[model samples]
Target chain A: MNELALKELLYKIADDQLILGHRNSEWTGFGPLLEEDIAFSSMAQDKVGQSYAIYQMLNQLGEQEPDTVAFMRNANQFHNCQLVELPNGEYDFSLIRHFLYDTAEITRFDFLANSSYEPLAQLARKIKGELKYHTLHANTWIKKLGNATEESIGRLQGSLNKALPYALGIFEPSPLEQEIIASGFFAGEEVLKKQWMEKVELLLSQTQLNLPDWKTIQPVLGGRVGQHTEHLQPLLDEMSEVFRIDPSAEW
Target chain B: MKFSKAEIFTLLEDVKDPEIPVLSLVDLGVITKVDIDGEAVHVEMTPTFVGCPALDFMKNEVLEKLKENGITQASVSISFKEPWSSDKISEKGKAALKQFGLAPPMPAHLFTDIEVMEHVPCPRCEGTDTELKNPFGPTLCRSIHYCHTCKEAFEQFKPVS
Candidate 1:
């Protein structure tokens, strides 16, 4: 294994999950409905927990402890795709983002479930089970609301169009992309992006939403190499608000 | 006799799930193996999910329960080798869940079928005329459902695949 390549891959995956999990948790008491509140929080816990497990794996490879790594990292040290770091602007935007990002993540986990790396494969297998419902939840809501009413459909369509460019950033090719692909670690972001497009296209076709010619969309990249939006640092600061207060205290 | 495997196994019944106190770990099928050597005990378990938050608390409870049984030297190990599925929840656990106002989990295979929600029996009235409030619930392993018959809402322990 190209160890550096592996580390890079892991960092991006873990960071993406951690950041998005935080965003999802923000809807705990603020969802449009009670069930949605619970659902967002449930998925939030799963995503955060998934990130924690990945961080533990990184620790085994000589990274710092999970708390230190998660709470203390600066914006430049992180490697998550920018799609997950954006604010949950509204229910429509948040839902659209969830639908897009999870479509790609589920595809990634499916490939990882069969990975040559035993530990990652094991973790992937378990995570794949959890993600089945998540994607299912996203799909059901998209189908229900995408064609429901003028307002709902219009809102979703608007957010979907707005999020598409940033969603494309999820496929930003890493420096070790080729090596990671060659080493049998993963199929690379290229394959994942292709699979995601097909899945998203199929799902959107069932609703009133219209997907623009994806090729025409300009992908907003750079989050993978640690360049982030102005939104990320504030989120990080808020996440570490309590942790930084008593780093050494056993809670 | 100092502690024996069967005795330790029986003693483990005292450990209850923190989230659902009505069911014991044994009843939940979380306890997979139990071995004993004199006063020392080794117990093996599997959590409902790989990243389940309750894993640590469950293990500590098992250890604590063992000590309460006068067995101090105990080790509780976890593995996803035999990943937990909802089918493992015992009949007693199911009954306990229903009586506690929560529906027992459907089989793991059913969750993928979408039909699992179409007929979730209400724990409140045992009514089949139920509506899915959300397929997601407060916990990772639960989902909310509403019963039209009794005008009540309940949670179902979702099957962990």
Candidate 2:
């Protein structure tokens, strides 16, 4: 296996979970409803915890400790797609984003469950089962809000349109995509993207939301190669503030 | 200085889940394996959830239990080698969970459809008429449900396949 390619794959996966987990945590007290609040907070714990497990795998492969890797990185050092870092605009946008992003994630982890890499495959298999609830939560809300009142439908549709481009960024190909696929470390992003699109389409078809032409929507890329939007640095700064203040402090 | 695998498991049975104190790690099925290596004992375990905060505490408790049992040279490792599922929970653990006012998870085979979560039997009233309030709950391993019969909300130890 190409060690660099493997690390890159792991880093991107871990970063996505960490960043989105932080965003989910932002919903801790602010969800539109009490259940939604607890739901997001719970998912936040799951995602952040999942990210920590992945980082531990990275550390075994010669990266920094999980805390250092998670808390010390600048925006440019992160490998998360831009989709996750965008501020939770509203309940509508957050729900749409969650639905789209989690669909891809569950699909990705499902593929990774069969990865040629033994350790990752094992972890992925376990993580895959846990993510069922996450997708269930996302799918339920998307369908409910997507087919409800005029305001609810309009808001969800608008957010879905706004989020699609960045959601597409999730599949930005790595330079070593072929190598990773060939080595059986992963099935590669393109395969994941295709499967993800099908699943997304299937779910949205059940709702009142519309899917726009794929060719017309440009994917907002660059997050894979460390280029991120202005929103990312501020998130990182806030996320790591407590850790940076006392790196040596025991929790 | 040496202990049998069964003896080590017996000691570990005293170490209950920090969150659900009524259930032992053995009954909960997190204690995947116990190996006796001459004078040193090594145990393998897996967490119910990837992000369960109680794992470290569980590991420490295992160590402490072994030490109190006079098996000082013992070690515990958390791994995904034998990944956990709700099905792994022993019948005894399920009863204990219910006794503790938390519903045990449905069998993994019956949990393929997420709809099963919507009508979990209430631990408090054993009422089948229940509604899933949320799939996520106070802890990573639980889900919230409301029982129409008892007019109370309860949690279930969520089933993870």
Candidate 3:
């Protein structure tokens, strides 16, 4: 088995969940409405829990403790795509990001569900089940906001366009993409991206939103390789504030 | 005197969900397995939601219930090997939820295939003309629905799959 490739794959997936889950958790008490506040927080818990599970798998593979690995990692050490780490600009942007990112995630879980790796396939089953609601939440709101009043439609459309490039970055090829694919672990990002694009197009079509042709967009890349936006480090620092107070202390 | 799955299940019936106390963990299908080995009792569980805070509470409750029932040694573990679905909820649990003024969970297949159900069938009025007031409710496990006929708003358990 290609351990490095598998570990790298796990890192990216785990990081994506953790970072986005952190961002979503910020919505607690601050969502556009009370229901949305609870909804985002609910999904945030699932995302964080999912990340913890995958990190536990990593610990089995000889990585650090889940707490140390997650709370101690610097921005550049993270393997999550740039899209997940970006600031939640507004409800419109946050909603758009959720829609675009989750579309790919559910697809990734589907691919991983049938992976030759037994552990990943098992984890995928549980993760996919939880992600189904997240995508459902995103799609329902996207359609509602995408086809709503002029202001709502305009806000979603603006955010959608701004988020497209970053969303494409989610499929940035891994350093050991081929090794991972050759081991029958995953079908590779190219396949996942195609499926994501198709799914996104289909859903976007249902609303008044417009998606630009794929060929014309420059995909934002580099979060998988540990490169990240300015937004990540501050978030990480804030996250680990209490944990860093005393690494040896138990909560 | 000996312990069996039937009695163990009966003992666990008193362990209710923290959020919705009307239904027991067994009724929600969270208690998937109960096994007896010599003097050790092993219990396997799955959470209704991956992030349900009540997981630890439920596990502790199970252990306490078993110990109180004279099974002093017991272990309760959460299993994530298989996904959980609302379809696993018992008929008694569904009725309990409705009688408690909360709508029962819809079939898993019907809930996930679409964003929201057009007709939720209000728990109070049994009216199919209920509107999805919001796909999200006060809690993660439910959604808000309003019955136009009864002019009352209620919550339905969101099908988890």
**Per-residue lDDT of A1-251 in model 1, one digit per residue for the tens?**
67888888888999999999999999989999987898889889999999998898899889899999999989888899999999999999999999999999999999987777777887887788888888998998999999899999999999998999999999999888988888888898989999999999999999999999987999999999999999999999999999999888787
The stretch of ten residues in a row with the least summed lDDT in candidate 2 chain A is A174-183
Chain A TM per candidate, in order of listing: 0.98, 0.99, 0.99
Tens-digit lDDT track of model 3 for A170-236 = 9999999999999999999999999999999999999999899899889999999999999999999
Q: Candidates 1 and 2: which is better by TM-score?
A: 2
Inter-residue clash pairs, candidate 3: none
Residues A1-251, candidate 2: write the lDDT tens digits: 68998999999999999999999999998989999999999999999999999999999999999999999989989999999999999999989999999999999999999998899999999999999889998998888888899999998989999999999999999878888898899998989999999999999999988999889999999999999999999999999999999998999
Model 2 alpha-carbon miss at residue B3, Å? 2.2
Docking class of 1: medium
Candidate 2 ranges with C-alpha deviation above 4 Å: none
**Clash pairs of candidate 2?**
none
**Best DockQ among the predictions, by candidate number:** 2
**i-RMS for every candidate:** 1.6, 0.9, 2.3
lDDT of 3 by residue, B1-161 (tens): 28788988988999998888999999988998988889999999987776676788899999998888888889998776655688888999999999999888878776655545668889988989888866666766787888999998889988766
* Ten-residue stretch with the least lDDT total in model 1 chain A: A113-122
What's the lDDT for residue A249 in model 1?
Answer: 76
